[model samples]
Target chain A: MIEVEQLSKVYGSTAAIQEVTFAVEPGEILGFLGPNGAGKTTTMRILTGYLPATSGTAKIAGFDVHENSMAVRQRIGYLPETPPLYPDMTVEGFLHFVARIKGVVAGDRAKQVENALTRCNLLEKRQVLIRKLSKGFKQRVGIAQAIVHDPPVIILDEPTVGLDPRQIIDVRNLIKSLAGDHTIILSTHILPEVSMTCSRVAIINRGRVVATNTPEQLMAELAGETGYELEVEGDIALAQARLAALPGVKTVEPIVDSVEGSGEPSRQKLRLSLVTGTDPGREIAAVVVNSGLGLYEMRRTRVSLEKVFLELTTEEKAIDPETMAAAYERASHRDTEPPILPISVTTDQTTDWAPDRTQSIKSDETPIEDETEASITAEQPSRPEEEP
Target chain B: MQSVQILFANLMAIYRRELQSYFASPFAYVIAGVFWLLSGFFFVAILLGPEGLIAQANFRDQLGMTNPPIDVAAQFVSFFLGTLSSLALFILPVLSMGLYAEERKRGTLELLATSPLTNWIVALGKLLGALTFFVTLLLPMLIYQTIALSAANPPAPFTGLLLGHLGLILLAAAVLSLGMFVSSLTDSTILAAILTFALVLFLWVVDLVGNSLVGPVGAGLKHISLIRNYTNFAQGVFDSSSLVVFLSYVMLGLFLTAQSIEAFRFQRS
Candidate 1:
C-alpha cells in the first residue's frame, strides 16, 4: 500500500534521512525498528505526506506523496509522536472534528466516530475533555482520531512509549487487530514490540537500513553457530580437553560456578560453555560419561532476535585508544569514585560485583558507539539539533 | 464547481473548529469584557460626562449666542468610531495571537498541514473566525449609542451610523488578517501579540511620518496609511478609493498569511 524510494531529507547540509527505501504490502504491518535518532520518524513523516523529501519519491496507493499530497493524505492516517490533540476538546468532539477535516461523508460521520471510539476502548470517556484523561487514554484518543476516517494506511510514531506493561499489551493487541484492514508502519525503539507485533521488521541504524526481514529469518540468518552450557562434577582440565577435542567444537570456556553451599562433595559442579558449528550436546554427554565425569545437565542455546538487532546496529568502526582513554577519563571524572575501604573488607564484595560490572560495561559500549557516531555525523554541519 | 464545494466544506470545518475553540477558552471572554468596559467608558465620558460635548453645547445655548447646530449625532458617532479604530490596534492582536501560534505550539499544525485542506482555506477560516468574534465584541457598543442618541434632541443619522460601523468592520478585518500573519510566524502567543502590536502601531502612525515628507512621497505615504484611510470612513464618507485601499489591505494580509503558512509547511517537510 506504500512505496518509498531513495527518500532523502536534508536540512541545510545535514541529512535527516538519506536514500531510505522500503515498501509495505497491503494488509501487512511493518515494524520500523531502530534506536532513538535512527530516522524512523523522518521516514514515516515523508511516507505520510507530512514532510517533503529533498530527493526521491514516496507513494501511497500509487499516488506520489509530494505531487498528489492530498490524495496520498486521504489514504493515510498519521499519529505523530505528540498525538496532535486539543486539550479543551472532548474525545468524541475531537474525533468528529478530525473526521470532518479528514473528509468523511457527513451522513456517516457519527457512525465512523462511534466505531473509532469503540475500537480504541474510549466509549466511556468520550464526553471527558482530553486534558483530564491519563497519558494512556490520551494515546488511545490519538489513535482513535487517526482511525476515525477509516484510512487504508496508518502511520504511528512510537505508539506505546509511555504506557504501562498492561497498556502496552492492550495497544499491541489493538494494533494486531488493525492489520488485514489497514497497512501499518509503526516506529519504536523498544525491541520486543517489533518481535511480537510486526509481520516484518526493518532495522535502521545511522539513517541506513542495515537489515530487513521477518523476525524468525533474521534470527536464523544470524544463528550460524550453536552453543551449549553444561554442569558437571569432574576434573575440570580433563573435561575441558575432551570438550575441545570434539570435531565440531570451536572453543571451550569454564564458567565460575557458585557451588560452594552444596552438601555433597561428589556434586561439586563445574559449569562450561561450548561453542561449536554444530550440536555438540550428544557428543559432550557421551564424552563426559565415558571420561568418568558426572554430567548433571546440558542445554543448547540459539541466537535471539535481540542479538541480531544488536549485531546489525552495533557494527561500528573501531575507536582509537586515545579517544577511548579520553572518553574513559571523562566518564570517570563525571562519576564519583567509590569510597576507599580496607582491602580485606572490600575484596569479597568487589570480586562479586566486578564481573557483572565489566559485562554490563561491555554491553553498553555497543549502543554508545552507535549514539556517538549518529551525533557526530549529525553535528558535522554545525546546525542546531533537530529532534527526530 | 465541485472543487469549490469541497473547498468550502473544508473551510467551514476549520472555521467551526477555530470558532468553537475561541469560546471554549476564558481568554475570549476576558478580552471581550475588557474591550466592552473600555469602549463603553470612552463612549459615555466623551459624549455625556459633566463637562462633556452636550453639556458645553447647552452652555452655549444658555449664553444667548445663535450658534449653528453642532450636529451632536455626527460628532459623537465620529468620535466613537475613532475610539473603536484605535482600540482595535490593541484588541486585535490579543484576539489573533492564538490563531496559529497555539496550534503550532500544541503540534496540531502538523495535523492541519498534512490534511487535505489547502493553506488558503485554513488561513481564511481562522481569519473569519477571529473577525466574527470581534464583531460580537462590538455589539454591546451599539446599545450605548442607542441610549445616548435617545436622550439627544437631534438623533444620530442612521445611514451615517451604519456607514461608520461598516468602516470599523473593514478596518478590523484588515488589522486582524495582518495579526494572523504575524501569529503564523511564531510559536509563542505572547511574541505574536507583541510583534503584531508593533506592526499595527507602525501603520497606525505612518501618516505622521508622511506629514513631514513633501510632494508625491507624502501623498503616497498618506494614501497607504491605515489610519488616514480609516478617518474618511469615520466621517461617514464612503470614498471609493478608501474602500479599495481597505479591501486591498485585507487581501494583502490574507495572501501573506497563506504564503507564510505554506512556507512554514515546506520548511517542516
Candidate 2:
C-alpha cells in the first residue's frame, strides 16, 4: 500500500532524513521505530503528502505522493503528533467535518463517522466537547477522525504517547483490528509497542534506516550474541576453568554474589556468565555436576528486544584523531566554569562505579591559591578531572 | 458537473464550520457588542445632537435661509456611512485576526492542507464566514436608521440609502479581504491585527501623500486611496471607476491571501 524509495529531505544544510526506504504490504502494520529527533515524523509527513521530500519519491496506493498529492491524500488518513483537533468542536461534529473534507459522500458521511466513532470506542463520548475530554479520549478522537472516511492507509505519529497503560492496550487492540483492511505506519520510541503491535519493524536513527525485519527475526539474529547467567556454590576458580574449557564457550566471567551475610566460608557462591555461540547449558551443567560443585541454578538467559535495540543503536565506533582532539579541547574549555553544584555534593551523588576525584582535586587547588594571589585560581580542580 | 458539486460541498463544509466556530466563542460576541455600541453612539449623535446636522438644519430654517430645502436624510446617511467606514478600520481587523492565524496556532491548518480540499476553498470559506458575521454586526444599526428615517415628514431616497449601504459593504469587503491576507502571514493573531491596522492606516491616509505630490505620482496615489473611492459611494454616486477600484482592491487582497496560504504550504513542504 505504501512504497518509499531513497527518500531524502534536507532543510537548508541539515538532512532531516536521508535515503529512507521502507514498504508496507496491503494488510501489514509497519512500526516506524526511532528515538526523538530520529526523523520518524519527517518521513511520515512526506508519506502523507503533508511535506515534500527534497529528493526521491513516495507512492501511496499506487499514486505518487508529490505528483498526485490530492489523490494520495484522499486515500490516506493522517493523525499528526498533536491530533490536529479543534477544541471548541464536539467529537461527532469534528468527525463529520473531517469526513466531508476527506470527500466522503454526503449520504455516507454520517454512517462512516458512526463507524469510526464505534471502532475507536468513542461512541459514548461523541456528544462531548473535545476540550472536555481527557488526554486518552482526545487521542481516541484523533484516531477516530483519521478513520472516519475509511481510507486505505493510515499514518499516525506517536498515537499513544500520553495515554494510560489501559488506554494503550485498548489502542493497540484497536490498531490490531484495523489490519487486513487498512495498512498502517505508526512511529514510536517505545520498543514493546512495536514488538506487540507491528508486524514488521523498521528502526531508524540519525535519518537512516539501520535495521528492518520481523521482531522474531531480529531477536533470533542477536540470539548468538547473548550470554548466560549461572548461580552455583562451589570453588569459583575450578568452575570458571571448567566452564572455559567447554567447546562453544567464548569466555567465563564471575559476577559478585549479592546475598547478604550467609556466613558460609567454605561454600563460595558465584555467578558465572558464559558468552557462547549457542546455548551451552547442557554441557556446562554436566561439567559442573561431574566436577563436584553444587549446581543450585542453571538457566539460559535469552536476549530481549530491548537489549537488541540498545546494541544496534548505541555501538559507538572509533573517532578520527583530529576530531577527537577538537572534542577534547572543547571539553577542557567547558571545565573552567564553576560547577553548578558543590564538589563534595556531586562526589557523594555518584550512583555509578566511576572513581570520585572531588577530594584529591580540591587538595591540588589549595596549593595554587596559597602560592600566588595574582594567579587565577580554579574554583574546583576536580571539575577538569571529571571531563572525559 | 460532479467536480463542481464536490467543490461546493467542500466549500460549504469549511464555511459552516468556520461560521459555527465564530459564534461558539465569546470573541465574536464581544466584537459585535463593541461594534454596535460605537456605531449606535455615532448614529444617535449625528441625528439628535445639539450640533448635529438635524439641529443645524433647524437653525438655518429659523434664520430664513432654508430656501434650497436641506435634505437631512441624505446628509444623515452620508455622515452615518462615513462613521461606519472609520469604525470598520478598527472592527474588521478584530473580525479577521483569528481567520488563519488561530488555525495555524492550534495546528488545524495541517488537517486542512493535507485534506483533498484545495487552499483556495479554505481561504474563501474563511473569508465568506467572516464577511457574514460582519454583516450581522451591521444589521442592528440598520434598524436605528429605519426608525429615524420613518419619523421624517419626507422619507429618504431609498435608492440613495441602498447605494450608500452597498458602498459600505464593498468597502468592508475590501478591508476584510486585506486583513485576512495579513492574518495568513503570521501565526500571532495580535501581530496580524497590529500589522493589518498599520497597513490599513497607511492606505487610509494615502490621499495626504497624494495631495503633497505634484504630477502623475500624486494622481496614482489618490486613485489608490481606499477612502477616495468610498466617498463617491457614500454620496450616492454610482461611479463605475470607484466600483472598479473597490473590486480591484478586494481581488488584490483575496489573490494575495490565496498566494500567502500557498506559500505557507510550500514552506511546510
Candidate 3:
C-alpha cells in the first residue's frame, strides 16, 4: 500500500530523513517506533504527500507523492502529530467539513461524518467545540477527520501521545480494531504500542531504518544464539574461567552480581552470560559439576524487544546536552562503541528514542554473527536511552 | 471528477467556516461602525468649515470649510475608503489569525497539508473566505448612500457610485489578501497583525512619497501609489490599467500565501 524508496528530506544544510526506505502491505499495521526527533514524522509527511522529499520517491497506492499528490492524497488518510482541527468549529461541524474536504459527496456527507464520529466514539461530542473538548476527545476528533473519507491508507503520527493511561489503552484498542480495514503506518515514541498494535515493527533511529520484523521475529532474531545466565557458588573469576573453557561455548562474561547482605562465608555468585551456538545447558552443567562448583541458578536468558531496541539504538558516548554542538565534537570519540553494528555511533544516541528504521534485522544476516556479537558485546553495552 | 469534487468540497468547507467566523465575531460590525463614524466627521469637515477659503476660491461654503464642486459625499467615501482599505490590513491579520497559522499553532495545518486538497486550493479558499467577510462589512456602507440619496434632489450618479464601490471593495480585498499573506508567515497572531498593518500603511504612503520626489523617480512612484488609483476611481473614473494593478496585488498575495504553505513542507523535513 505504501512504498518509500531512498526518500530524503533536507532543510538548508541539515537532513531530516536520509535514504529512508520501507514498504507496507495492505491491511498491515506497521508501527514506526523511534525516539523523539527521529525522522518518523518526516517520513510520514513524505508518504502522505504533505511535503516533497528532497531526493528519492514515495508512493501510496501506486501514485507518486510528488507527481500524483492529488491521487495519492485521495487514497490516503493522515493524522498528524497535532490533529488538524479548527477549535472554533464543533466536533460535528469539523468532521462534516473534513468529510467534504476529503471529497465525500453532498448526498452522503452527513452519513459519512456520522460514521466517522461513531467509529471514533465521538457521537456525543458532536456539538462540543473542539477547543472545549479534552485532549483525548480532541484526538478522537483528529482521528475522525482522517477516517471520515475512509481512505485505504492511514498514516498516523503519535496517535497515543499526551493521553492518560486509560485513554492510552482506549486509543491502543481502537488502533488494533482498525486492523484489516485500513493499511496503517503509525509513528510513535511509545514502545509497547508497537508490540501491541503493530503487526510488524520498524525501528528507526537517526532517520535511518535500523530494524524491521514481526515483534516475535525481532525478539528471536535478537536472541539468535541460545544461551543461559549461570550463577555459581565459587570465586567469581574461577566461575568465569571455567565457563570460558567449555567447548562449544563461544564466549562468557562474569556479570557483577550484587547481593544485599554481606559478612557471610557464602562464596561469590558469578553471573555468567555464556554464548553457545546451540543448547549448552547440559554442557554447562557438566562443566560446573566437574569444576567442583556449586551450581546456584541456571536459566535461559530471555531477550526482550526492550533489550534489543536499547541495544540496537544506544550511542555509547553522546555529546553532553550541555555544551551543545561543542560537546558533540568531543562526543564523536564515544560514538563508535555499541553492542551492535553501526559500530561508529558512540555519540549519536539521539536517534535511539526515535524509530531507527535502519535497525531492521537483515533477513540474510548470519545467525552465528547475531549470537556471538550480542552476547559478548552486552558486557560493554551502551547505556539505555533516557525515557521522555 | 473525484479530485475536482474533493477540491470543491475542501474549498466550501473553508468558505463556510470563514464566512461563519466573520458573522460570529464583532470584527465586521466594529470595523464598519468605526469607519462610518470617521467618514461622517471627514464629510462634515470638507463641507461646512472655513468660509474664508471658500470665499477666496469662489467655491461653496456650508459649515466651516470651503468645498470644490467635488461630489462631497463621493469624496468623503473615497477618503474613508482609502483609510478603510488600510484598515483591512489591520483587521485581516487578526481575522485571518487562523489560516495556516492557527493550523500550525495547533498542529492542525499539518493535517490540512496532508489532506487531499492541494495547498493552493486550500489557500485560495481561505483568502476568498476572509475577503468575503470584508465585502459584507462594506455592503452596509453601500446601502448608506442609497438612504442619503433618498433625501436629496438630484439622485446619486448610479454608474459613478458603482465604479467607486467596486474600486473601494477591490482595494479592500487586495489589502485583506496582503494581510492574509503576512498572517500565513507566522503562527503568532500579534506578529502577523502588526506586520500586516505596517506593510499596508507603508504601501499606502509609498505612492505619496514617490510622487513628491523631484523628477522621473516620482513618475514611477505614481504607478505603485495605492491612494492614487483609488482617487481616480473615487472621482468616478474606472481605469482598466489601475484595476489590473489591484488584481495583480491580490494574485501576488495569493501566490505568496501558497508558497509559504509549501515552504513549511521543506522546513518540517
Candidate 4:
C-alpha cells in the first residue's frame, strides 16, 4: 500500500535520489536492495516523512506523505537505520511512551506494548534498562518500538546491520513473520537478506532502480551461466575435444593457469560453458571417462544473487534509463503475464547474450571476480531455497 | 474538544518523560545540590551575616537616627529575587541546553518529528518539564525565605512578595524558552549552553548600552532589556507591558523553536 512516483530529493547541487519510482502491494515485503551510499536511506527517509522530497510525490496508505504527513505517519511504522531509542528508559517504558506518541489508545497501550515485546521476543528484558542491554537486544527493542502501535505499513532501514549471524537470522525471521498482515519495505545492502526474506527485490544503483522482480525471476533471468569446472588427471586436450563434441556443450576450454607449460602435467583444469537450460553433467562425465581421462573434480558454477547485485550496482554504464525502458518493454513482450507491478526499469542483457564477446574474453579475465566465483561455487550445495 | 484533549495528553506524555529523565540522572541532582549550596550561602550572608541588611537595620535602630521608614522585608525580597534572577542565568542554561540537542545527538528527534505530535507541543512540554524542575530547585530556598519573612515586625506584604517570586519564574520561563531555541540549533549541548549564556547575558545588560544613547532606538533597547523588566517585576510595579515583554519572549522562543524543527526536516543531514 505504497506508491512512489518520480521522487527526487536534491541537496544543493547533487540529487540524493533521482526519479526513483516503485510500489508495494498490501502484505507484500519489498526488498530495497542497494550498496552503501546508493540512496536507499534517502528513499526510505522520504517515504517515512522524515525528509521532504524536492519534487514528485510519495503516498502511503492513500495519504500523500508530504501534504498529509500526519495521517500518513499515523498509518506507518518506521525504524531508522540507527534505531531511535532512549537508552535511559526501560524497554517497556520506552514502548509505552512510543505507543502513546503513535496515538494508540491509553486502554490498549499496555496490551500493545506487551504484544510487541512478545513478538520481538523481548518479554524477559522488558524490565531492564535499554542502556544495559547488548546490541542485539537493543535492536530487538528498536524493532519492538516500531511495531508497538501495529501500523499497517512498516519501513525498516537496514534492520540487520551490525548484528551477529545468528541475530541476523532471528531478525530476518521476525521480519518475515511480520509480512502477512503488514506491508514491509526493508532496505539492506546484504544480498542474502533480500533473497531469504523479501518476496520482490528491487535493485537500485546510483539513485536509480535498475530492476524489480521476484527474487527467483531475478536470479533465473539475470544469472550469468550454468557451467562446470573439471580437474582431470589425464589427456586434457582429449577430454576437451570429447566434451566440446557433445550437444548443448557450448564451449570447452583448457584453464591456462592449471597447465604445466614444459610438459604434460598429471592433472589439468578444464572449464565448460554450457548453453542455458542444459544439464549435461552425466554425459560429460561419461565422455571424460570414455576418452581415457580421469576426472578428479567437477564443480557446478552459476551466478548467485551477489553477482546479479554487483552487475546491477557496480557496472558504471551498463544501464541507462532508455535502455532500461527498452529492456523492460522487451521483457514484457517476451512474457505473457504482466509484471507484478509497474516496473519502470529492468535489464535484458540475458536475452541478447553475445557469444563472440565470450570467445574474445579469456577465462581468467571473465566478468565474474575470482572471489565471487569461489564463494558461489563453494555455496552451491546449501543454497537457500525460499527459506521455507 | 477532543483534539485539545489529545494535544494535552501528548504534551503531558513528553513532559513526564522529560521530568523523569531529569530526576533519574545524577547530573541534574548535582546541579540542584550546587544550587542549594550557593543559594543557601547567599541567603544566610545577605540576611543573617554581620554586615547584612538585618544587622544594618538593627544598628540604625540603636542609633535612633530615623531617616525614613525603611521596609526591611520589602528590601530583602527585592534584593534576594534580583540575586536569584542572576543565579538563574547560569543554571537555566544548563537545564535547557540538553532539551533538544540531546535528542538530536541520540537521533530521538527523528521519532519526535515523525510522530503526530506538533513541534510546538514538544517544545512546550520540554519547557514545562524543565521549568518544573527549576521550581523544585527553588522550593527549599523559598521555604527559608517564607520562614524568615514571617518574623518581620510587620508581616511582609504578600502581593509584592508573591509578585517578586512570579518575576523569578517568568524570567526563568523566558530564559529557558530562549535556551531551548538555541539548543535546537546545534547538537553540541556545551555550545548551546555557552551561546545561550552569551545571549541571555547580552539581553540582561542591554539597558547599560541603551543608557549611552538617546532616541527611540535607545528607548526600544532599554524597553526590551530583561533586567529592566525583571526589576519592574521585583519592585511590584504591576506593569502590564513588562508582562507582555516576558510573555512575548516566551512565545517568541517557542515560535522560533517550532520553526527550527520544521526547517530541520529539509536540512541535508
Candidate 5:
C-alpha cells in the first residue's frame, strides 16, 4: 500500500535520507530503525506529507505524496516526534478542535473524541487543561489526536520516547492492539521495539536502509558458525579431542564452569563449546556416549537483534557529514539506489541439519506494490499469509 | 464553499480561544479599565472644572490649552483616542501573539497546515478574533463620544463624530491585522509582540515625522503617513482616499499574514 522509490532529500551540505526504497504491504508492521538524526524523522515527515522530498517521491496507498498531498494526508495519521499540543486548552477542547480540522463528521466528532480519550485512558482528564498533565499523559493525548481520525495508515515517530518503562509498555501494548486494523510505520532506534512489535524490521543508518527482514530472519542470515555449549562429565582433554575429531567439527574450546547457581560443592562439570560446520550436537553426543562420557546438557545460543543492528549499521557509519547529510536526504526521499537488498539466505549443505525447527526460511517473494497496507492493523481479507 | 467553511471553522476556534484567554487573563480587563478611567478623567475635566468647556463660550476652550491653543480637547481627546490607537499599538501584539506564533511554537500548526483549509482562512480567523477583542475598547469610547456630542452646546460635528469613530475602528483592525501578521513570522510570542509593537508604533509616528517636514519632501511624506490619513477622519471629513488607504492597509496586512503562514509550509519542508 506504500511504495517509496529512490527517495532522496538534500539540504545544502547534508542529505537527510538517501536513495531509500522500501514497501509496506497490507496488515504488516514495518519497523523504521535508526540512530538519532539517522533520517527516521525526516523519512516519516516525507511520508506524512509534512515536508517536501528534495528529489524523490513517496506514495501512500498509491497517492503520490507531493502530487496529491491532501489525499495522502487524509489517509495517514501522523504522530510527530513531539506531540503537537496546545497547553492552554483542555483535553476535550483540543480534541474538538482537532476533530473539526481533521474533517471528522459533525455528528460523529463527539463520539470519535470520546472514544479516543477512552482508548488512551484520558476520559477523566478530558476537562483538564493539557498543561497540567504529566509528560506521559501529554504523549498519550498526542497519540489520541493522531488516531482520533482513524486513518488506515498510522505513522508514529518515537511514540515511546520519554515515557517511563511502564508507560512505554502501556503505549506499546496500545500499538500492538491497533496493529491488526492499521498499517503502522513505527519509527524508532530502539532495537527491542522492533523485535517485540514489528513484523518486519528495516535498519537504516546514516540515512540509508542497510538491511531489513523479519527479526528472526535477520538473526539467522547474519549468523556464521553455529555453536553448542555443552556440560559433560568426562576427562576434559579426551572429550575435547573426541568432539573435535567428529565430522563437521571445526574447532573446540573449554568454557569456564560457573557453578555458583548449581550449589554443588567441589563438583565440576566439563564444558565443551564448538564451532561446527555440521550438526555436531547430535554427532558429538553419539561420539561422547560411545566413549562412555557423561553428557549432561547441550543448547545453541543465537545472536540477538541488538547485536545484528549494531554490526550492520556501524560498518557504514564512517560517512562524511556532507555524505551523511546527503544520504539522509536521499534516504528520506529514497532518491538513489533501492536500499532493499534481497534477504536471500540459501540453505545449502546446511539443510542436512534441519532439526533447528525454529528456523523458517524468509521468502524474498514480497512484491513492492503492497508495502503500505501490509503493515496496517486492519485485517487483510485478501491476503492469505501476511507474514514475511 | 470550501473556503467559507474552513474560514468559519477556523474563525470559531480562534475566536473561542482568544475570548477565553482574554477573560482568563487580565489583559482585556486592564486595557478597557485603564482606557475608560483615563477617558473618564478627561471627560470630567472638560465639562466640570473652572476653565471647562462649559464656560469657554464655545468648544474652542474645550481644546484645553492656553494662548494660541493646540485644541487639547481634540488634542487630548485625540491623545485619548490616540491612546486608543496607541494602546492598539501595544495590546494588539499581545493579543495577536498567539495567533500562529503559539501554534507554530507548540507544533500544533501542522494540524492546520495539513488540513484542506488554505492559509488565508486561518489568517483571517486569527485576525478577526483579535479584532473582536479590540472592538471592546473602541465600543465604550464610542459611547462616551456620543454622550459628549449630545451634551455639546451646539452639538458636536456629527460627520466628524461618525468619521472619527469609524477611523478608530479601522485603525484597530489595521493595527491588529499587522500584529497578527508579524506573529505568524515566528514561534516566539515575546518576539512577535515586541516586533509588532515596534512596527505599529513606527507606522503611527511615521505620519508625525512626515507632518513635521516643511518642504516639498514633507508634503510627499505626509501622504504616506498613517496618522495623517486618520487625522482627516478625526476632523470629520470622510475622504475616499483615506478610507481606501486604511482598507488597503488592512488588506495588505491580511495578505502578508496569509503569505507568512504560506511561507512556513515551504520552510518547514
Candidate 6:
C-alpha cells in the first residue's frame, strides 16, 4: 500500500535521509527500526506528506505523496512524535474535528469518532478535556485522532515513546490490532517493539537502511553460523591451531583473556564461531583429544535478535585502510604468540551477548588473507542478508 | 457542488473548534471582561461625564450658539466607535495571537498540515471564527448604543449607524487578519502579539508621517493609512476605495498566511 523510492531529505549540508527505499505491503505492519537520529522520523514524515522530501517520491495507494498530497493524505493517517492534540478540547471533540478534516462524511463522523474512541479504549475519557488526561490517555487520543477517518495507511513516529511499561504494551497491542486492516509503519528506537509488533522490520542506521527482513529471518540468518564455547586444560595454542585448521571453523579465540595473568595458564576457556551450516563438533572434540588437551566443557549457542540488531546498527563495517592493515598485522602476529583474545571478542559465556561478533570474527579469521582481502574484495560475510 | 459542500463542512469544523476553544478559555473571558469594563466605562463617560458630549451640547444650547448644527447622536456614535476601535487595537492582537501560534506551540499544526484540508481553508476558518468572537464582544455595546440613540430628538439615521459600525468591523477584520499572519510566523504567542501590535500601531499612525511629506509618496502613504480609510466610513462616507483597501488587507493577510504555512512544509527545522 506504500512505496518509497530513493527518498532523500537534505537539510542545508546534512542529509537527514539518503536514498531511503522501503515498501509496506497491504495489511502489513512494517516496523521502521533504527537508533535515535537514524532518519526514521525523517522517513516517516516524508511518507506522511508532513514534510516534503528533498528528492525522490513516496506513494500511498498509487498516489504520489508530494504530487497528489491531498489524495494521499485522504488515504493515510499520521501520528507525529508529539501527538497533535488540542489540549483545550475534549477527547471526542478532538476526534470529531480530525474526522471532519480527514474527509469523513458528516453523517458518519460521529460513528467513526466513536469507533476510534472505542478502539483506543478511550470511551470513558471521551468527555474529558485532553489536557486533563494522563500521558497514556493523551497518546491514545493521538492515536484515535489518526485512525478516526479509517484511513488505509497509518504512519506513526515513535508512537509508544513516553509511556510506562503497561501503557507501552497497551499501545503496542492497539497498534497490532490495527495491522490487518491498515498498512502500518511505526518508527521506533526500541528493539523489542519491532520483534514483538512488526511483521517485517527495516533497520535504518546513519541515514541508510542497513537491513530489512522479518525479525525471525534476521535472527535466523545471523544465528545460522553456530558458535561453540569450550573450557580446556593442556596446550591451548595447539588445540586452537588444530580447530582453526578445520574447513568450516571461522575463528578461534580465548574466551577468558583476563584470567591469563591470574593463574590457570594451562587451563583456558575458548570459543569457536563457525562458517554457515558447519558444526564440526565431532571433529573439534577429536582435534582437542589428539592435541592432548583436557576438554572440560563444550556448549553450543545461537545468535539472538539483539546481536543481529547491534551487528547491523553498531558495527563499523567500513574499516579504513590504516585500521585494516593494523588489524591484519595484529592477526598475523597473534599466530606466533599465545592467543590473547582481541578486545572486540565479547567474553560472554554464550553468543547471546556478542554484539561485536562481526569484528571479533573478522579479526581472528583464519589464513590471514580472508581477514584483509574479504573486507575490501566483497561484502562482509557478517552483514545481514536482506531481501532485495 | 459536492466539493463546495465538503469545503464548507471542513471550514465549519475548523471554525467551530476555534470558537469553542475561545468560549472555553478563561483567558479569552478575561480579555472580554477587561474589554467590557473598559468599553463600558468609556461608553458612559463619553455620553454623561462633566466634559462629555451631552454636557457640552447642553451648554452650547444654553449659550444659544448652534451655528454648525451639531447632531449630538451622530457625534456620539462616531466618537464612541472611535474609542471602541482604539480599544480593539489592543485587544485584537491578543485575540489573534493564538490563532496559529498556539497550534504550532501545541504541535497540532502537524495534524492540520497533513490533513486533506487546504491551507487557505484553515486560515479562512480561523479568521471567521475570530471575527465572530469579535462580533460577540460588540453585542453588549450595540445594545447600549441603541438605547442611548433612542433618546435622540431626530433619531440617529440607521444607515449612518450601520455604516459607522461597518467601518469598525472592517478595521477589526483588517487588524485581526494581519495579526493572524504575524501569528503564523512564530510559535510564541507573546512574540506574535507584540509583533502584531508593533505592525498595527505603525499602520494606525502612518498618516502622521504622511502629512509631513509631500507629493505622490505622501499622498500614497496617507491613502494607505488604515485610520484614514476607517475615518471615511466612521464619518458615514461610503468610499469604495477605502472598502477595497480594507478587503485587500483581509485578502493579503489570508494569502500571506497560507503562503507562510505552505513554506513551513519545506522548512528544514
Model-by-model DockQ, in order: 0.62, 0.56, 0.61, 0.61, 0.38, 0.77
Candidate 1 lDDT over A111-150, as tens digits, reads 9999999999999999999989999999999898889999
Point out where model 4 deviates above 4 Å: A222-224, A227-275, A279-388
Cα lDDT tens digits for candidate 3, A112-164: 88888888999888999887999999888888888889899988899977776
lDDT of 4 by residue, B1-269 (tens): 99898898899989989998899788999999999998888898889989889998999999996799788888888888888888999999999999999999999998888788899999999999999999999999888889888999888877887888888888899999999999999999999999999999999999999999899989999999999999988987678898999999999999999999889778855
Q: How far is candidate 4 from the true structure (C-alpha RMSD, Å)?
A: 8.3
Q: Name the top DockQ candidate.
A: 6
For each candidate in the order shown, give its overall lDDT on alpha carbons. 0.75, 0.76, 0.67, 0.80, 0.68, 0.80
Candidate 2 ranges beyond 4 A from true positions: A228-277, A281-305, A308-388
lDDT of 4 by residue, A1-388 (tens): 9999999988998888888889999999999977666689999988888899999899999999989998988888888988899988999999999999899989999999999999999999999989899999988988998899999999998998778767877898899999989999999865556767899988776677766888776655444355666778777777878898998788776666543223447887766767767778889888988887776767664423333343333232443444334433344443334334322212222323211112111123222342244333433343321111
Better of 1 and 4 by lDDT: 4
- Across A262-325, the per-residue lDDT of candidate 2 in tens digits comes to 4655454333334534556678778888888876544343222222243222212322334323
Q: How does residue A376 of candidate 5 score in lDDT?
A: 25
| RMSD to true structure for each model, in Å | 11.7, 13.2, 8.5, 8.3, 10.6, 9.6
TM-score of chain A by itself in each prediction = 0.65, 0.66, 0.70, 0.66, 0.64, 0.72
Q: Candidate 6, clashing residue pairs?
A: none
The residue-by-residue lDDT of candidate 5 on A139-217, one tens digit each, is 9999998888877888889998878767877887888877878888988755556667788988887777877788666
Q: What is candidate 5's lDDT per residue for B44-65, written digit by digit as tens?
A: 6655556664556355656655
By TM-score, the better pick of 2 and 6 is: 6
lDDT of 1 at B235: 89
Q: Score candidate 5 by TM-score against the native.
A: 0.73
Against the true structure, what is model 5's DockQ? 0.38
Question: Which numbered prediction scores highest in TM-score against the true structure?
Answer: 6
In model 1, pairs of residues that clash are none
Positional deviation of residue B233's Cα in model 4 after best superposition, in angstroms: 1.4
